[model samples]
Target: MAAKSSQTMTIPTDAELVQAQADLWRHSLSYLTPMALSCAIQLGIPTAIHRFGGAASLPDLVTTLSLPPSKAPFLSRLLRLLSTTGVLASNEAGIYSLVPLSYLLVDGVRIDGDASQTALVLAVTSWHYMEAAMGLADWFKKDIAQPVPSPFEEVHGAALFEESMAVLDPECDKLFNEALAAHDHMGIGTVLRECHALFSGLQSLTDCCGGDGTTARSIVKAYPHIKCNVLDLPKVVDKNPSDGLVNYVTGDMFHSIPPAQAVMLKLVLHFWSDEDCINILAQCKKAIPCREAGGKVIIIDIVVDSSSGQMFETQLLMDVAMMVYTRGRQRDENEWSSIFAKAGFSDYKIVKKLGARGVIEVYP
Candidate 1:
């Protein structure tokens, strides 16, 4: 059963409506799935299972993860949810196997011959490590879904980009970058695998609001013929080496974007309000040529309802995450179309749907 059954089973049978509502209250209060997965990853459950000869039973899983007898059943419940959520899977024989998503976190999972442990990077999804403020009031009550400024900004008056540059904690910065890189590993890698056709015929592309150029590097690697530039604030470029496959340009997307055949904005617009998005899109408009000249904005981000096949529930949870983290919110097709119209775009097409994000081609 989809974990989403937890989200949609609002009304219950005729006899137990009161009991059902009481049960719903408790189930709705549980937000520990991601946290538990993080704990399992941090404790190296997959690694332990692998070393223990793969596909272990519940007791074996408990032993591998080092749980007490009292907590064994709790661990089993955790595993059950993790399995349902696509992180792990269970068998008829009662053994568990890491799914593709979890195996991707196995230490030394490689790409392009580079082997690095997924240790620190897995923190990206750790609810404790990546906490957003309380958006519950607005989220449960209001229809608007825009995220606030990132949690760091909510507390420290600075965004992650700014903090990465100004903060003196090099170790924290490195770990943070690793987390971003891991996310890029999934996000960038997913798009390249499922939607490479969108990059065809593009000779030049710039990643607006690109931090550290991980996505740009992925794009350039997939389409080596195309020249890619990552445009961000001056501080991010000052700290990062420009020697990668992607050229690094120091600039703000709202002020101006370097000229390119196309502008790629991934996980950016949701950071701003409608007015802010308009400013950024206007700058993107000034950067690219006409659609006939291959001028377009290639956006890889969640378009809320674009692909509701089985991910609608995950998408809704992600929408709440945005509420905690930024003033940005994921938009449905209508919301996107409205933004495109306001930005003076002629037409747009939602391309391939992959995982949580959908590839969108916006014409200038």
Candidate 2:
């Protein structure tokens, strides 16, 4: 046993307490940083800079981005903050250049006036989605067990899916659907390149809730021998053209999934609760064959882990999105295991090829 001392604890000085308060206040204002990025994206700053041979002076940017003379000073300040925060790079002469981070915001080579899919995702997150997060504390004060829907429902008066289906906001629906397609363009392409072996043996695959058939199209293009089908809601499938490359089926994944050799649920599981996810997985199991027949559910979503720095931060941020917009979550390995076990999956394998995300294969 150690002897106890009568020493008094040191008290913080007034200056120390004031400095701590300042630090807290600084963190509180950090939202302005992302808001600045959103503003830049809205103003087409990234594309402007890229068009200027990857570097542009403030005046050149103001002209290229078509900012009015009145907003030039404010735009300068925004760029300075973005550069200082390492979202972009600035040279000694105050010329701005695109960094790897800002490059994702650039319009794709096939630009049609919309923001890049990645940029659209960022913009949407900062808009109504973030407004929902702002109400989280107040939402938590309610009796959560009473089917609160989500924090999004607390603010918007409806769940996100319901609102999207209702077409209450046409602009929001367009943005959300386009963002999903863009995300699939970037993420699914990377997954296919990294894990081509996963799709090798499957003769037929169904991309459940696959919007616009981007994933199915990509898969069919890469492996023409394997037939791919996209199953989504009637309204969503109705908009997709009969491209002849892939078949589009109108249905709900909760009730049933069209029969296929394998079921591919890209970015779907994270948008539902445990019970809903289990139900959906059971449907997937029913749609596919036994493990010996090469049937499995392929999931592309974030797996929360603390081992990586940026990836862990990304997963935490996405978890907050799920909390705010839906009754879902970014699950850790154990949470995923529980869901898979509950869904009657005998085994699962996680392919950590996608940065900040993973490909999970669940076998029935």
Which runs in model 1 stand beyond 4 Å of their true positions?
1-14, 58-81, 84-86, 111-160, 164-177, 306-309
The deviation in Å at residue 38 for candidate 2 is 1.2
Q: Per-residue lDDT of 296-358 in model 1, one digit per residue for the tens? A: 998878888735866887688667656554566777889888998899999999998777778
In angstroms, give how far residue 255 of model 2 lies from its true place.
Answer: 2.2
Q: What TM-score, computed on C-alpha atoms, does each candidate reach? A: 0.79, 0.89
Residue 227 CA displacement from its true place in model 2, Å: 1.4
Tens-place lDDT per residue, model 2, 1-364, is: 6544545545669999899899998899887877888878788888888888889899998877777888889888999999999889998898999987787787774432232655454646555677788889899888866444788877877566565424556666566656666665666666777897789888999999988887788798888988888999997899999999998999989899999999998888998888889999999999999999999999988889888787898799889877887888899999999999999999999965478788999999
What's the C-alpha lDDT at position 63 in model 2?
Answer: 79
Per-residue error for 28 in candidate 1, Å, reads 3.5
Among all candidates shown, the one with the greatest lDDT: 2
